[model samples]
Target: MVKQTNVKNRKLICDKLLTFQTQLEADYSDKLYEVSRKRYAQIDDLENVHTGFKSAVKREVKSLIPFSDIYKETIKLSFERVDAQYQKVEREYKEIWKEYSDNLSLNWSILAPAVEGMATFCGKVMRVLTSSNEEIDVSKLKSILYLKELNL
Candidate 1:
């Protein structure tokens, strides 16, 4: 009877462990998806900002014929707008890094064995963003990606 009870308890523990593993995997996968989506959105925003800046530069050049204090002011404002957009992008990158860092910190205990897996996921994401064919350059985004890719 004691042997049967021990077997039953072992089975219960095994089942619980399996459930925990599954949940952990799902959580990590969800995080990866979220990060990928956010990265893509940031890329889109960067493209839009680049396009707008180019257009503003073209406009300024065309208005050189009517160069005046007003035109100069308009150019100055456009430049400032571009600066603001770059700053916003920088802020967003930092936010994403923080989010990933927080999530990893939260799950560290439960995901110790899966640390390498998580790092691989992050590395793949970085590769996708840094690829030459990628629409947006993310070379500067490597630090955040690498940190998240660390084997916890």
Candidate 2:
């Protein structure tokens, strides 16, 4: 009886852990999609606005005398802003991935042994159920059997 209760508790914990893990994965995926969409939008805006301006400047500088030092410095500063934005996006993505991996590792470590033990206990229960010559309580056996099937 105590063994049966332990198995039921382990199965419950495993199911809850698995559900939490699935929810975390879904949240992470949604966050990644949002970040990717925003990144693409930023890239598109840069291409539409800055690319045309840069091309016009290059063409004017080529046809005319030359680019002023101020123009060159302004372009460099614009590029620096782009670089900073890229770095910020990369860091945010890295942090998200780290959090996802840490959560996954912790959940898996806790749930793996519990799941394995539950399986072992179920196997033992099955052996006893099938091999015993005496009659058993069918309701109790069915309840325990249902508990064994609660995967995630």
Candidate 3:
């Protein structure tokens, strides 16, 4: 997966990577470039991989340029870098989800008393309206179109 969840970025990265691959092949050996391309081809979602790939390529090429295609070590490092980024993104998502859940629970806890208070007030109003209490002139309230005032 890419670092970002959006579509346009993934496409841009892929395009940049393709151009970068052509340049690397021209600058370096074909075998080395092919190894890099093969490693990248395996990944399905290439979000934030552009940055990771660049870093990994720099490190790998710097270390391996003088020598022959040290295929496994060089390619594996790049793969590790990309995979690490994927893991990091997943971890970040989980942390955000946990924070959201915690906030929702806290909100429910805080609002519970307020909800109860509203219910109590509604009960008190109904009692005043229904009871023949002289203190509350219930007749002063507006009448509903189809409802007659109830006699207690």
Candidate 4:
């Protein structure tokens, strides 16, 4: 009778653990999906901002920069800085996804790092972009060339 009770208790514990694991997996997967979707949308908006900035620069800077060597260099440096900012964000985004996928299991708590990294990455791109604009602005460049308003 004791042996039967021990086996039943073990079975009950195992069943409870399995249920918890299943729920955790579902919850983690849902959270990841939702966050990734929002991040992707943000990336799309960033791309649009980049496109608009590029178009404005091409149209405005091309005609303006020829007159001032300092302005030309400033614009070039600004473009490079913006590109680097984009690459950093992209790298962090990929790293989070890779980390999640590689350690995927019942460990939903592991997502804290990924989620925090995601949250921290937010607004950084724009910050970099706008700071670059400051340098451009000092050169007396057009305000239209700056990413003053984010699409988001």
Candidate 5:
């Protein structure tokens, strides 16, 4: 009876942990999506700025004499400014993603082994509870399993 109770306790703990893991995964996914959306929006805004500036420069140059020094200087300065802004944004985006990736790796390292252990324990229980030669299908346990994220 004590052994049975211990098994029950362990199963309960696994269920709770699995639920928590699922929630954490969902939150991480949402954060990733948000970050991607913001980054793309910034890129779109920058592209619009670049296109608008080029158009304005073209119009201004049309009013100047061909190959004028002033037109040449204006084009060079505009290109430099736009290139600097793009590089800065790219650096910031990479830094943000790098930090996120580090955290994700750390979390997975801590979490995956525990999850795998629990899954193995559950599989053993299933084996023992069924006939010796019975073929267990983990997918069929979805009704009783808390790990909705796992394909198994």
Candidate 6:
């Protein structure tokens, strides 16, 4: 058991959470989002209206589709151009999601302990400050965090 009479005796828990969130966001943007952007850059055509598709392929197909319309050939390939790159974009998107998920998992893993550690430290400090009570058993706090590995 522990006790503290003064409000100033305890540290604010909100500050710890805010710091964790800020660091997580920074790491996600730097480590995950940046890498994902690079992957997407490989497939993205930065020239014109085509964002998700390679520019050369889209331009070539667009030129051919107009002729296909007049010739009654109906290649129907222009609209389907993006479908070809769909897998690549999908892969990029998936990686980004996986990275974000990984970062979140990592953040939680670190934060859970950080918070618990602060609480434990604060508990002891306040305990000593206000009383000389015996220490409580904190075995369960050291337990592992079991998480399901989902098929991504």
List lDDT for all candidates, in order: 0.47, 0.44, 0.41, 0.47, 0.47, 0.35
Superposed by TM-score, candidate 2 places the C-alpha of residue 34 at a distance from the truth, in angstroms, of 8.8
Best by TM-score: 4
Q: Where does candidate 5 have its weakest 10-residue lDDT segment? A: 131-140
Expressed as tens digits, the lDDT of each residue in 22-140 for candidate 2 is 43234333333443554223333333333343344334323332335533543354345444554565677669768865776555776888887996787567545533233222222
Worst 10 residues of 1 by lDDT: 143-152
- lDDT tens string, model 4, 65-117? 34354345545655665556556666777787689778866666779688768
Candidate 5: the clashing residue pairs are none
- Residue pairs with backbone atoms closer than 3 Å in model 4 (clashes): none
Q: Which ten residues in a row have the lowest lDDT in candidate 3?
A: 143-152
Q: How many backbone overlaps does candidate 3 show?
A: 3
> How well does candidate 4 match the true structure in TM-score terms?
0.36
Residue 131 of model 1 has an lDDT of 39
Where does the lowest 10-residue lDDT sum fall in candidate 2?
135-144
Quote each prediction's TM-score. Answer: 0.35, 0.30, 0.27, 0.36, 0.33, 0.24
Cand. 4 Cα-lDDT? 0.47
| Backbone clash count, each prediction separately | 0, 0, 3, 0, 0, 0
Selected candidate, larger lDDT, 3 vs 4: 4
Ranking by TM-score: 4, 1, 5, 2, 3, 6
Task: Give the TM-score (vs. native) of candidate 3.
Answer: 0.27
- Mark the regions of model 4 whose C-alpha exceeds 4 Å error after superposition: 1-48, 62-68, 106-152
